[model samples]
Target: MKAMRVKNGLKISVIIMFIFMYGCKQSSYKEFVMADAVEVSESYEIVEEKEMTYKLNSNQTNVPLNLKIIKTASSRYKVKNIVTATRRIKIIAQKHGAYISDLRFQNDLYKKENRFTIKVPQKYFDTVMDSVNTVVDFVEYENITTKDVTEEYIDIETRLKTKLEVKARYETILRKNAKTVEDILLTEDKLRIIQEEIESAQGRLKYLTNKVAFSTIQIDLYEPVEYKAEPETYTKTFWDETKQGFANGWWYIKSFVVVLINLWPLLIIGLVTFFFVRKRLKK
Candidate 1:
């Protein structure tokens, strides 16, 4: 009986040892799995970021396919009649869905001129020019200018996209990793700066888009009048000259009186000096 009891106790000790070992192995495996999951999550995030960046770069590279152009024209010409020509041009602009941005009319001694600044759609630029030609008697000059802004447009769009991505990352950090007030404040400040830059980029893009959409045409229309010659020298009638001479004499007398009044103090002093000298001479 005593041997049997000792054997059973030994058996129980062996069983306990095996259980403890199995528990340790299970714990280690669990820890390893957790570590692997964390590493995988980090890798996935990295891949997603890289993909987004690649897409943005691809879009930027394709900017040259669609060109951004700004067109402007200036025309100076002579017309038969300023008012009639101006009216006809207005009708033409209205027919083509264009508007006069500015109009200036001036009548000089030798000519009448009307200046117009018209804004037309890009598609109607050539049509408007041709229509305006119908009213022109003589074409002094016509200048057309084209500018390419594709590079600048691409640059702004790319920068805006980058800034937006950075802002989103900062926001994520603020929400998840910012544990202290200082960290939160710093993250918010960075986000504010990024937002401002994004808004600036958006505004520049809008202005460029508008400029590309519309074309500007400046028209100067003028009409020449017959020359009127004036006499270089005029001879006044004898009666007119006599009247002018009398008026001049009266003006001189008035001027002399004003001078005497202005020198009253000096005149008084000279009279006193003269009287004193005369008295001394008499004595």
Candidate 2:
């Protein structure tokens, strides 16, 4: 009985050991499978995110640009010299892929000025400005303005696309689904409005595009007034004194005439009184 009992205990121990080992293996396999599933899910998410990011990046059609306008004032010593500089400026502008949009000049005793408005291709804007700087003797003022229209441009582009899509939808409806005259007329009206909006947006886009592609520069050149004095010779001084005396004499004669006119009434009264007094004395 003692031996049987010992054998039974050994059998029980072996069975328990086998069951524990099998359970541990099963748990490890399940954990591995779960980990693998988690890894696959994470990888899929990463790929999906990458794809989304790429799509978003690809949607941008053009780079946003800032429109710039530059203004500068330069001076040359001589008024005539400014003309040469102006001609040279025009030549330089043309060589740098620029054009003179406006030119104005003023020639006067006080000041001489030459103003130019130039439009330069954006790619050559800096080159043109540098060339212009070389053409002047002195620089007075420089102003540069930049406008960020990226948001505005993008908004307009989006609106334009939406409008075009709406227009196409209307056209499709008009061609395929409009069964009655009323339907046709209504669709046509919608199409017209959409078309007008599209045109307006197009015009605005074109203006923005031009502003981005070209930069404006205003250049002002001037020569300040110079007063000259010449030394007077003795003969010239004598003539000047003579002319001054003649002017003073003329002024005195005019003063005498004015005084006589003012005293006429008093003189007339005095003369009458004298006549009356003489008559009384004679009587």
Best by TM-score: 1
Clashes of each: 0, 0
Instruction: Itemize residue pairs with steric clashes in candidate 2.
Output: none
Candidate 2 per-residue C-alpha lDDT over 132-168 given as tens digits, one digit per residue, 9 for 90 to 100:
7787777766777677676788899999999999999
Off by more than 4 A, model 2? 1-80, 228-283
Residue 170 lDDT in candidate 1: 100
Error of 1 at 182 (Å): 1.3
Q: Total clashes, candidate 1?
A: 0
lDDT of 2 at 189: 98
Alpha-carbon RMSD, each predicted model = 31.9, 21.4
Candidate 1 regions exceeding 4 Å error are: 1-65, 229-283
Model 1 lDDT per residue over 1-283, tens place: 9999999999999999999999999999999999999999999999999999999998888755488999999999999898999999999998888899989889877999999899988889999999999888999999999999999999999999999999999999999999999999999999999999999999999999988888999999999999777789989999999999999999999999999999999999999999999999999
